[model samples]
Target: MSAELDPRLLTRAREVVSSITGFRDDAIANEAMERVVRGELARGRSSADLLGEMLFPQSTLSGTLVRAALVGETYFFRQPEHFRYLSQVGVPAALRRGSLALRGWSAGCATGEEAYSLAAALQASVPHGFPVEVLGTDLHEASLETARRASYGTWSRRESAPRLFPLYLDGVDRQVTILPVVRRITSFAQSNLLAPLPERFGRFDFIFCRNVLTYFSLSAREAAIALLARALNPGGLLFLGAVEADRVPAGMVREGTPELQTFRLLGPGESASPTPVPRFVERAAPPAPLIRRPMATPVPVRAQVTPPPPPARLHLEALERIEGGDVDGASAVLESLVRQAPDYLPGLLELALLRERSGAREAAVPLMRALRMRAERLPPDQLVDGPEALPARFYQASADAYLNLGALE
Candidate 1:
């Protein structure tokens, strides 16, 4: 757009755009880059001058365009329904029959928001915690660094609804930080959804390759879909962004409202060949109950409390603390136990239940609901009623939260 525009810079812009998105329109690419730099710098004359120097002065922009393009906006709970379906339907169906270890991949996971979001959703659904894991991969190493830092602006907070707002801690600068509970279950790495997935990456129970496929050409899209399909463990579910769904296989079923298409991988001894879409079969007999009564509350330790009980006998003390309204102290013990012994499903359930009792109901609800759903999804050979049950309080509070949001349907 300038009389003295550097042809070299224009070429660099086109190359950057094409490499990042596989789009080859040189003129459109330069126009977009100019617009991005100009828009970001337009706040003041000084900022405008700074951007002009950064973009126009140099023949090659220093990773600036890629950073700008990938510093996308996202929030803690950006897509509520997708998560709900994950909790109550998708995950459970996947894990129903066995003591299956589940893995989830968030391809093109920009800045870690989506991966952390999946971690939160997974924990909510698999209370008393099943064997589950999450992996977040983005092509940009720098973007992965920002995600590793795990901080975001008020702009990111826009994705959370008021009902769930209290669940996140807002920083002094109005940035939001994901709670420690959500961070424990996920890890991030640099990955490109195209090309061979890294040797270390393996089949997963769920894959979320969202909002990215639209950028690829038809051939690239199909190859990526095939690659993703191969990456899924049979019976795994794949979730796509709303716009990217059509690029996935035509035989896959697309469900849920405002759908980001969700597909299920065929189990072993099965094939990916299209099957007549199955009807919603009524569930078999209900599984056994999780708990018979309110669990014992945890207690606090005091120097004066005398002869600290043996670790095994410490349960009563911890129980007493919860009974005496020291839910936070009780939670501390359960959390420590879960960390020391990740296989301790009971500890996870107790912590989840105590969280609900402590009025963190919105956070607790997903744990119980997700647990039930995942338990149901286990393969028939490995099936068992999950080791934990939700306290009535959790469901009641969740029901209220849903009603408040008019999400009761």
Candidate 2:
């Protein structure tokens, strides 16, 4: 299969992919082209015809090439912190301005997990009777079809909190279907991030383009960000994946802790703008307090006491148990460590991995869910007095676990 195609033909295919999808990775573009070539040859079609089809606008082959070049890795509540910020920060600000109507856009919303997740978060956080609308846009029509179906296997729900399942899904046999309430507020459409947004797709108060920008070329990423910026209302919040923190555009101001990867569009007078003024004239108010829950009763001061051994020690002990083939013991140690320090990212991750390896993936679900919840409340700079204490590193570790376990792509 590899011997038949000319080198120049493959190079032409690669160039066409970059020009169409704006994917900059040479290796990925090459791989996708090779696969397309092989598949076309297998079907007794000429490489020239395949390339011509792919170059055609919105061709099925073109969509296939783009989908191959990009990953649609997503799950319900994959990044809980962003939803937390939306609920605890973005929503209340809008409500306070006497606007009960809220609009949100989930750009690159793979199969609608993110769009449904956002709707669920709003339903759970906001008071009843508050109106909300969510639009999910992606480049692939097949993904949109699945999004419209709203049924998922258990793997898609791996990162979903147990409490959220009952609130948003109905399970029958192996399939979990999204409830009407969540589905009613959300819609999906096919859209390319590099292209201009549809005029009917109005500006939104919140735009979520998490984990999608890193796949594009630098110029393409800038164009996508600019398009997202144009879609945002004045002072609207734009949430990117933590990995995309470095790629934020010029007209936006980073908001929340640095780890959060949330940005706010600066108002017209607040900053220089190369783009036109936002469509919505209403500006966001000063940020409301992040901690919305009431504080517990204050306790009297007590004498200083010795602190327990650091989480690192327990983590090592757990590792020793795994080495000794005592998986139960290791699990017990990790469970205790996480209980002692609920925000101990490493402990939570190790425990979840252990459960997954032991053929008890369900047992790991709650732990992973808990870790995601705690991760939301933690500051990005927050560190534990133990191994792998860097919050960003911990997040990377968590992401790795999710990918390895098939919770993410």
Candidate 3:
């Protein structure tokens, strides 16, 4: 591969790849296009033939370029909070609302892990024999095939991943297959966010499109969100990546006070209204009969008291700054958050990582030690009091690396 390109070709390459896969990384897009161009040239295809494909990026040849550029890196139970919320609140709430069957979609699902994880969680939460279906979609055919195989290596099982339910059958040679029960409820297919999801795939009770939209162009991202929102059942939940969390689609209400970055699609007659009343009345009530109705008691309107910002919100703000490449701003926010809530584990851990990243190893040591001490006092499985509610062992394991490295120094 030449790895060299004309400026015009590079610009056109980015547009074509972005149109096909919605990838925002120019370097990856350019590199992949160069490699594909070389292959096409070697295959005796003329430059004009390649230009035609660029004009129609949805063609099979263009899909090859997209597959080349995409990085399919995902693991089972990648973010546990979404799964935790599903089991604790989402599932129960759906049952309470009289949902007979549960359906879920994992948009941008790289492989079967997330889809299978969701299936396992739903199976555990719902009653026996209750219907459950989970669809995992990715643009890559190889990834979709791997998902269909339902087996993963040790790398897919990170320490941070929690076992919210039975996820695997058994391990052999460091690879495990997802349990048959879970696999039975889960399916994988190749699909693009830029296109409409098939109508045969009905509205879902919840959808996990986490960490996927970050690759899209701005307009495409908004369009994709609309599709995801539209795919949801009224009052359905949408889980997004932390970086993509703030971009709540229209007709959706962000849920929870923490930085879980989940949203709820408004059901029929549901309003993302400013008035936080118990329930919305359909229409104007008929005036009470003038003679017989007793005098109504006066209802007092209370002042809307704003609560102080939680450590989680501050932490999320800091994370957003970090993602925006504003390291100094993120550090300042984390510092202020720590002063306000010194016991906040996630903040302390994040600050320590930032410090370590900035080559201030000594500054990071105490933060690591403090977090480790707090984690040790709790049972290993006990969830720390924080935004994601990750277990104590997770913090301990995270802190151990820094603490051990410091000791080595």
Candidate 1 regions exceeding 4 Å error are 6-12, 24-29, 32-65, 68-71, 159-167, 247-258, 271-409
TM-score for candidate 1, residues paired by index: 0.55
TM-score of 2: 0.65
Clashes of 2: 0
Deviation of model 1 at 27, angstroms = 11
**Rank list by lDDT:** 3, 2, 1
Supply candidate 2's per-residue lDDT for 347: 85
Candidate 2 local Cα displacement, residue 4, angstroms: 3.6
lDDT comparing candidate 3 with the true structure: 0.74
Over the stretch 117-144, how does candidate 2's per-residue lDDT look in tens digits?
8888777767887788899998877889
User: Residue 170 deviation, candidate 2, in Å?
Assistant: 3.6
304: Cα error in model 2, Å: 38
The per-candidate count of clashes, in order, stands at 26, 0, 0
Which of candidates 2 and 3 reaches a greater lDDT? 3
RMSD of each: 18.4, 14.3, 17.5
